[model samples]
Target: MIPPAFRDPVHDSQSAFRRLLKALSRPGTPVSLTGPAQPPAPMGGPLAAIALTLADADCPIWLDPALSTEPVRRYLHFHTNAPQIADPKAAAIALIGDAGRLPGLNEFHPGEAAYPDRSTTLILQLPALTGGPSVRLSGPGIETTASLAPRGLPGWFWQAWHENAARYPLGVDIFLTDDRIVIGLPRSTKVEAP
Candidate 1:
């Protein structure tokens, strides 16, 4: 049976949304998500909370093959009432369970000049949130530069991120999560290897 959603949808969702906004605003800073529901296997708590908070009937979600499981689909559908789309370009949110096998950064919609906000937002679930190769981040919302060391990402991720960042207002945004912590990486942020 599918687990129940948050005990109080209004309050819980609002709290989660605030945390997400703060994370996105201060890119690379970690935020903790609290909710009543615990997601099934392969879906971290923070990621599940994000899906419930951000996704709705208007937003369609795309799942990587590794995350396209019955329990996950059921949970998201029952809680968010969001459609599941097959094409990555059509997804408002893309969930990547295994960053090691992540699709090319360009595969998803980068949005258009006229409507840059339509680009997909990725939620990548990693094994750990710290202690890996660090990347220097600088841009809006950053004073000078911030360093982040997200573990379990593919080696080519930084290079692809550089290319994606070059797209300016047209690139997708990302939220990296483990079990409880979440860090945002908006497309506007410049990522450099350290």
Candidate 2:
């Protein structure tokens, strides 16, 4: 059921779509959006806008264990006509809670040599965004170290990302959303510890 606040997606879609598009267009940047995003049972909170902006018939999604319930999956399938996949490599979108449990940086398809655009996008249900020990992201789209409070970019990820960077035009792009805001990890952004 659409939330009471979002009875009108036709209108809401415009703003939500703009925020998502802008976030994707600029790497190492953050965007804030709010409104009728009442996610379904067990799927918890961020489900609403996530369903609205990311799902579609052409994209395949891989749900984390926390989001693997039948009701949640069914709701997404019914609404978006998006297929669900078991392998992250096959998914165009991967929904997860802990970025830690996801397959090592090498396992998922980080796009290909030529068609680097064919990479997976990961959406995480973050516990919170904080300041300590965080990294600063900056590059082409970022004006400065886009001081990001990303919680779980595991140690190995930094190492592997260096490898992905080696692939240059071929690497995965990341979009992270918390309860209040969403941020980007564009393939072009560089990460350094704060």
Q: How would you encode candidate 1's per-residue C-alpha lDDT over 1-194 as one tens digit per residue?
A: 99877788899889999999999999999889775556877887788888888999999999999889999999999988999999999999999999889999899999999999999999999999898899999999899999999999999999999988999999999999988899999999999987
> Which residue pairs clash in candidate 1?
none
**Quick one: RMSD of model 2?**
2.6
Predicted structure with the largest lDDT when compared to the true one: 1
Off by over 4 Å in 2: 1-6, 41-47
Q: Residue 25 lDDT in model 2?
A: 72
Per-residue accuracy of model 2 over 67-171 as CA lDDT, tens digit each: 887767776776678998998888888887666666675666788777888888777656555643566666777666577666665657655666665666777
TM-score of each: 0.97, 0.85
Worst 10 residues of 2 by lDDT: 39-48
